[model samples]
Target: MEVRSAPSLLPILRSRQQGEVLTYLMCDPDRETSMSELAHRVGVPLSSVHREVERAEAAGIITSRRSGNTRFVRADTDSPYYDSLSDLLVKAFGPPHVLAEALEGVEGIEAAYVYGSWAARLHGVAGRRPVNDIDVLVLGEPDRAELYEALGGVEGRLGRPVNVVIRDAGWLRDGSGSFHATVTERPVVAIEIKKQLGRDPVPQSS
Candidate 1:
């Protein structure tokens, strides 16, 4: 017997690549992204990203231009579907970037990742049920109270609960827990936290 999987996070899109492409471009409409950068960020081949860009361009979802030997693209903000599509992508595929932005300036966070079912979908894994929440793994000694406060409204923005698991860097390097083993073996989306200058590195009490 065979089992069937549920639809992806955005069933309206034809493929995960399509969703990823749109998400990266639409979520950051103000910036122009190079094709190579898009491919690198989307974790797909250049040729594959090019095809998706062409399809999106043909549909007026994005616009592209060439500079020297590189091609840059951004969301077509003039399109009628731009607003709604961007909102959808933000809710469906924008966790890593969104969470990264939200976590910025909070002291003592060395690294972060989005794992579990939402990440499984981002990794193109088909599941029996749709993802209903986001799981985040934070490796650092960030103040728990500050951390939670930073992420307080993420659920309201993403339309799903955001579950965060915090641990020290040592745990990631040498932990023997079953949970650590599972997360290490699975696909996890890395979240980049930009450290702000002039901010104290002290970890506040919870």
Candidate 2:
């Protein structure tokens, strides 16, 4: 799995840091986070997070309240742009973020990628309809019970169910038949999981 920043989210929010800030606040609307916490989660400077949070406040996209010396911020549901931006952020960053967080440190996972409608939308494919469910393709045999438990957090965050398909490593490595072909042809967002160690999840053409 490649460790990379989400450049796809930049155009939607005009800044990756801002998008991340929004993700933390809006993904779980009830939860309030401080600028310092956002900075840590977003892997950016505290000053940058402060600037984005202030900008969001000015735009009425989010609201901040003080608790003693600490201030916590959350999305302003009253703002008309709140729902739309939340949906966009969920689509752009939700699955990848969820997958990485949930599946990290879980054993027997070689690789993971998001496919189907959600992935199509992520890549900006023309005519891709609204995504109602997330489709995840997981390589290596993981315990079904544990995997489902992990995915529960993702479902809650995205407000949709996650449909995960587990496959054997050899099945993909051998380039077996139509399923492999379809996965290779379509738009796929590779998930950077901490436990993955194997061949490329995506197949190369002959």
Off by over 4 Å in 2: 1-88, 197-206
Q: For each candidate, what TM-score against the reference?
A: 0.83, 0.59
Best by TM-score: 1
Across residues 1-206, which tens digit of lDDT does each residue of candidate 2 receive? 11124444335356556676777677767877887887786667887778888998999999999989998888999899998888878766677776887999578888888887766654545442456788888888788889888987678767678998888776555766787777777788777785665556464221
| 75-168: candidate 1 lDDT, tens digit per residue | 9999999998888988988998789888996788888888888887766677888789999988778999999988876777787888999987
TM-score of 2: 0.59
Q: Which stretches of candidate 1 lie over 4 Å from their true place?
A: 1-7, 196-206
Clashing pairs for model 1 are: none
Residue 1 alpha-carbon offset, candidate 1, angstroms: 29
